[model samples]
Target: MPKPSSTKKVKTIPVPKSIRIDLTGHQYGRLTVLGFAGYRESAPMWKCQCDCGTVADYYRCNLRSGTSTQCVQCRHADLGVRSTTHGQWGSPEYRAWEKVRQSDNVCKRWQSYENFRKDVGPKPSKDHQLSRKVTTSAWKPSNVHWVHRDNVVQQKSNSHLIRFRGRTQTLTAWAREVDLSPAALRSRLESGWTVREALTTEALH
Candidate 1:
């Protein structure tokens, strides 16, 4: 019988000091030898083992020479997928967003929304925790009038609450009590009137 040939030891390449392996998705640190085909010194690519048991190319220049230690799949797991759609432009949810985008009065706010979509991504919901009143449902064309933030304070102050006070009073009725026409009160508030001016009964007269 022929004697068994002695097995040659395979050379293990040293991982670079700067190299960082994305191990979030991987359960083990050891690389699967099957996926990474034996070293090809001539080519610029190497087959890398994936946690999913799939083989992928890990550029030698990227792995040993640079910072890449794992396949593209591992990299994607670290960074969430980025969306290409604008916040309101392509969304089917905000159907009336197109009209606001074209209107002159609302164009400024719409432009801001568009810019935000370009930078981050679509967010149909309000994210500012400081202001609890802002909501996606309230950010409509008619509701969102272009006035200074201070004017928003003025409107909030003058706004009538017609709870069950014997009989609910219409805004026109409340204006009558304050001795001012509904149109006049609305104009004062819309024109960025001071909070004190909106609250005082003298403005009504």
Candidate 2:
């Protein structure tokens, strides 16, 4: 009988240890790292305390990336404020208000639902959105109005409007009229092209 072939044993590689960083006493946004919670799925976790007096576990990466902030109570409170402000949390009016507040950098004055409702009044319709009469103005009662969503878009579009050949239209509208992509036209404008050139330029296929 032929001699049995010698079998070569395969060597197993040991798993590399993860680099651990101590985040104790480090503040990330509203959270202060207290200690290491342990590991989950081969990643380190941390125990953190929020300024609002809540303690929770957060992924190590989330703290370092500024992604985790505030406790559950604060997050719920914020969502409640937004939802109660416009009769419902997921309403179109509330979402519109949120978008306007973020875009215009409106200060938060209406902490209570009553204050927000008293100032903004009731939502007229599902199709209506909170709008600012003056684009540069804040979301206060004096500056805000309930307008159709299309009207809001038109109003925002008017801000960057171009006037050429006795015609006034937004860059997007001009691009549509001239058979150019709105995104390409905007890019050209951003690159310092004149409105005429941006609107007139043919889009490359």
Candidate 3:
């Protein structure tokens, strides 16, 4: 039998372990990281609580990249959509809310979709719009309602401009803003009444 040739022995080097990032008690937008959740696809995830008190898990990349700032409800609230409770993200109501949610006319309380939905209720029909009784007034429960587009009042031109509450608009616009009657507002403007006076004066209603 032929003698076997001697072979050299090879040694393997140990790889260094990855350092895990500790994110406990870190706040990102409306979320506060509670602890490490687990790993997903070899990536780390974290458990977080939203400002609204909802808890959920998110990937570290999403939080660090600013992609997952808030929990589902709060995020959807900011987007004028619902989580699993209502309709889809791009629904008509979502589109309508998108147009006005950023405006100063929207009440700060409405920032929470829960409050908005509770006060305004659901959209009656696709033809309806979110409207305020006083066109220029901020959106609130008492003044807000769903009105059909066709039946809504036609806005007049900005011919007669009046400045109120650090903002300027036409008489028609001001009429919808404050509770003051249009006739009274026009009289006030024509009589050289200050915006504060017009907004603070007793209502004719």
TM-score, one value per model: 0.23, 0.39, 0.37
Clashing pairs in 1: none
List the candidate 3 regions with Cα displacement exceeding 4 Å: 1-88, 155-205
Give the per-residue lDDT of model 2 (tens digit) for 1-205. Answer: 1222332222222222343356777888777777767644334567777776677877655566444666667766767765653456765555555454333235467434446666887789887877667543345778788888777766767675677788977767887898777666655543334455456544434
User: On residues 1-205, what C-alpha lDDT tens digit does candidate 3 reach at each position?
Assistant: 1112421122212211332467777888877777767543334567777776666877665676565677777655655534455554676665666555644356778766567777777789988888666654566788777878876645223335566667887776777777656776665533333456556644522
- The candidate maximizing lDDT is 3
RMSD of each: 24.8, 17.1, 20.9
Clashing pairs in model 2, backbone N/Cα/C closer than 3 A: 83-89
Comparing 2 and 3 on lDDT, the stronger one: 3
Instruction: Give the distance in Å from residue 102's predicted Cα in candidate 1 to where it truly belongs.
Output: 17
Worst 10 residues of 3 by lDDT: 7-16
Error of 1 at 126 (Å): 27
Error of 3 at 34 (Å): 38
> In candidate 1, what residue range of length 10 has the lowest lDDT sum?
128-137
Model 1 earns a TM-score of: 0.23
